[model samples]
Every structure is written in structure tokens, then in C-alpha cells.
Target chain A: MSTMAFLKRSPWILHYDASSCNGCDIEVLACLTPLYDVERFGIINTGNPKHADILMITGGINELNRAVVRNLYEQMPEPKVVVAIGICAATGGIFRECYNIAGGVDKIIPVDVYVPGCAARPEMIIDGVVTALSILEEKRAKMTGAAQIKDDARQAAGETT
Target chain B: MTVNEEQTTIGVALEDLTREVKALQTDGYRLVQIGCTDTGGAYEVNYSFDRGYQYRNLRLTVGPETEVPSISDIYWGAFVYENEMHDLFGIPVNGINIDFKGTFIKTAEKYPFSVTRRGGDQCRNA
Candidate 1:
């Protein structure tokens, strides 16, 4: 399949609000609204973990939600992309000094894209999602090539034997 | 009045800060921090900031009996602050929707500051 086709078919994004003040969460919803129109790009929010290709996480991972966040990350299939949304997710924002908070989301899970803003503007979120899509596309290409190369190597070995 | 001008004259009385805030909102002033401090005899209620990050501290003295107007409607951040202030000092902030069910202190009994002095001390008895 063409790279464009590969990108278009990838439908799933899981949005997890770890411990944010609901600012970034609202902005994520705004992206889905008619104004930003993220749906046109084939980016969709998924409820089930198994179906998701991208994980869009908002808020700084606090002590209460850290384990749950990590578990959700582990549940996602390989080649999955994690996008950390807002300043809280990227650097813990104003809540950074609080004892209850565990710094940023990256400390809990590996992040593929970091969207910076106290409550990140919808435009920046879209940019981050697009970046995640690009990263996903690259990974898919590498995986496909690796599988084809492995199959070819096996076929050659079989013929020799 | 814009707080960005270093110091804008806020003509309202300390107790009238809440009313002034309501008026300011009509003229466009976003509420920031609703904090308090214990001033020996009374608790000083402070409503801070004008808009965005620019801050202006307006304080009102409440001596246990006074009920400070809640700014929850103005700034959503004040909900937690009001609850925190209630938990620390037994000051009742009027018109706050959410139950200030103690975020800091667990019990309902009045203990404004730390439990420094306990009645019938074991140390004294010993």
C-alpha cells in the first residue's frame, strides 16, 4: 500500500487525562470541533486500548494516575505513538512544585510528540498529532521492509537447503 | 483598571474587593488568586490579580464572624483555594457551591493553625 494510503487508514487515538486541570482536555475536544476539524485528517479518539494506534495523553502524571497511565501505555500494540499534550504533560507547568504531582508524563511513559502550552492551543495539538502520524508512517515503512527482507532471507535459505 | 500599569488605583474597600471584582468583570478583569493570611487577631482575605498574569493584592480582614464573598464564579481556580482556606482557617466563604470538606485538615473540629498547644499536656504531667 502507498504511504498516503497507510496514513489515511490509521484511525485510532486514545486520549488519557492523567491528572490535568481539564484545560488541555477541553482543547483536545476543541480539535474535534468544527473550528479545528481534526476528524478530516482521519484522527479519531478511541475508547478501547487494543484498537488505538496513537495515545494522546493530557496532564502531568500525578502519583494517583501514574500506574494507570503506564498500564494503558503497555496495553497499546507495538509501533504505537504517544503524544504528550500541554505544558503540564511536557514539563508539569504550574503544578510542577506540588508534592502530589510526579513531574511530566514522559517520566511515566515514552513520548513521541510534546505539545507545549499551559493549555495548548488547538492548532499546536493538531501539529503534534500530525507529527505523530509522520512518526507512525515511518515506523510502518521500516516494519514492512524488515518483514519482507526476513521472508526473502528465509526463501533463499530454503532453496539452498 | 489594568494591572499591567505597575499600580492602578483600586478605589474599593478591602471588604468590597469581591463587589469591585464583579464590577471589574463587567469591565473585563479576570480573577487570579483568592488567598488568605493569619494576622494575629484576624484572617486577611486577599483577592489577587487583574487579568492574565498581572497581579494586584486586595486584602479584607475577617475576625472569625465575617463571611467573605466567594469568587468561584469569577475564577474557577478559587474553588480549591477557598476550600483550602476553609480547611486551614475556619473562615466561612459565602456562596461557594462545592462543599469545603477539608482538603488539608481531615476533621471538622476547629483548629485554625497547627495543634501546638494541647489541653492537659502529657509533657507537663510527666
Candidate 2:
């Protein structure tokens, strides 16, 4: 009914692949397939990070790509959610033994939801995204209150001056 | 030629398994690990399941210079692993993306560990 509710329900998402084996990357695309139909749930994959409400990351964070991944996370707008898909993103699966891999994605960004699997199943990824939306809604509510408090503080400061 | 009960586990020749892997249609066994240990100077290559869940480890022995058949056509993942082995051990896998000159070693020279006349003379001079 409300504009805020509509916006919260249909938040745009962006997919980022740090350096995956193409297994998890393909499974992420499977979620958007006609069989699963993630778009029906109001989850749209946006090309630009500025319009994204959630960042779905797939891959084990490596030393080389750590900075690039962090920069992308910073570029996203506030009240954003992060979803780490696949075992590599959650805990660095087979590549964990490799010296170059920097471990899990959470070490670089604040992960809201983690979908664990070598290459997370399509159904599970959809579930994780939906779960992230709920968390984002709660965060949005808190941020709205925080913004109102900041505005009130500014008004009071103007009067005192 | 005949199977012996006492030497069953110890000498169950890997040739039998390799034949089975080659016979497969869609999925095939792929060599995963290949390297030489400092203990006995023996080279070992371990082939495991390339596709499906149920698969067993198959071990094979070859000389340090012997060229092994490539399973890149069956399992695409083998390309990277084979390249890594070539970089570390200098073992060549035939039919592989041979352009994998060297990976982490950062050199285009032939087998760094191999002893040549120049290396021997340098050692003698030293």
C-alpha cells in the first residue's frame, strides 16, 4: 500500500564474482531461469551497483581480488544487504588450502546471509535472497528512525546558535 | 598374470583401472596429483573421478620424463591441474593446452630442476 513498502519488497540486486570456478556463477544464473522465476518475487538483477539494494557475492576471497571486492561493496547505497553464496564464499572450500586465497568473503564485507554449498543449489540461493530482503526491511526501518533523530538534532542546534 | 591372494592389495596393477576409465563415454577419470617425493625419487600420478559422485582413486607410475595422456576432453577442470603439475614437476600431459609454459614459477626455461652440462660445469667451477 505504501511507497516505502513497495520499494522494500522489490529491491534491486547486483551479482559480483570475485574469482569463482564458474560453478556457483552458473547456479546463480539458474535462479533467474524460468523454472525458479526469481523475478516473480520482486528480485531484479541490476547492472549498476548504485541502484542495488543487495549484493550477491560468489567465490572465495583471494588476495588479488580483495580490494576490488571491498570497493564494490562501498559503492552500493545505504540500507544494503549482502548475501554470500556457495561454500567458497562462506568458508573457502577446496581452494582453502591454496596460499593465494584469502579465506571467506565475510572477512571483507558484512554478510547478512550465507548460503553454503560447493555451488549452492538454485532453490537455496533464492531462499537466501528472500531472507536478505527481510533483514533489509528491518535495517531500513532502523535507518529511517536514525535519520529522523539526526534531522531533529540539526534543528535544535540551529535554534541554539 | 594371475591374481595372488597375499599380494591383492599391494600389487593390484593400475592398468586395469586405466582401461576402465578410457572406456567410459561421457565421464572419465582424470589425473589430479602428480609429483615426486624426496624420499625415493619416484614419480606418482593419482587419477580420481572426473564426474558423478562415486569414484575411486587410481594411482599410476611413470618416469619423470614420460608423457601422460590428457583427459582435458573429458574433464575441463583437468587443464588447470595439469598445468600446475607441468609447472612444478616438468611432466608433460599430451593433448593438454600446451601453452601452459609455466604457472607460478615465472620462467620460460626448460625444467628448472634438470641438470645440464652448463649447470654441472658451474658446480665444478664453484
Interface RMSD of each: 9.3, 8.6
How well is each residue in B1-126 modelled by candidate 1, as lDDT tens digits? 754455443334656766777776786676666666667767777776676645566667667546667777776667877777666565666766675455443322333341221122111101
- Report the number of clashing residue pairs per model: 0, 0
Give me the runs in candidate 1 sitting further than 4 Å from their true place: A1-4, A7-10, B1-126
Worst 10 residues of 1 chain B by lDDT: B117-126
**Top candidate when judged by DockQ against the true structure:** 2
Encode model 2's per-residue lDDT on B18-115: one tens digit a residue.
Answer: 35446543355444443333223445666654333344455666665556666666556667766665654566567664445554343223344432
On a 0 to 1 DockQ scale, where is model 2? 0.05
RMSD of 2: 10.6
Per-residue lDDT over A1-161 for candidate 2, one digit per residue giving the tens place of the 0 to 100 score: 25688787688989999767889889988887799878887778888998999999998887557888899899998889999999889888888777567788998999999998887999899889889989999999898889889989999999999
> Model 1 misses residue B119 by how many Å?
25
Chain A accuracy as TM-score for every candidate: 0.90, 0.92
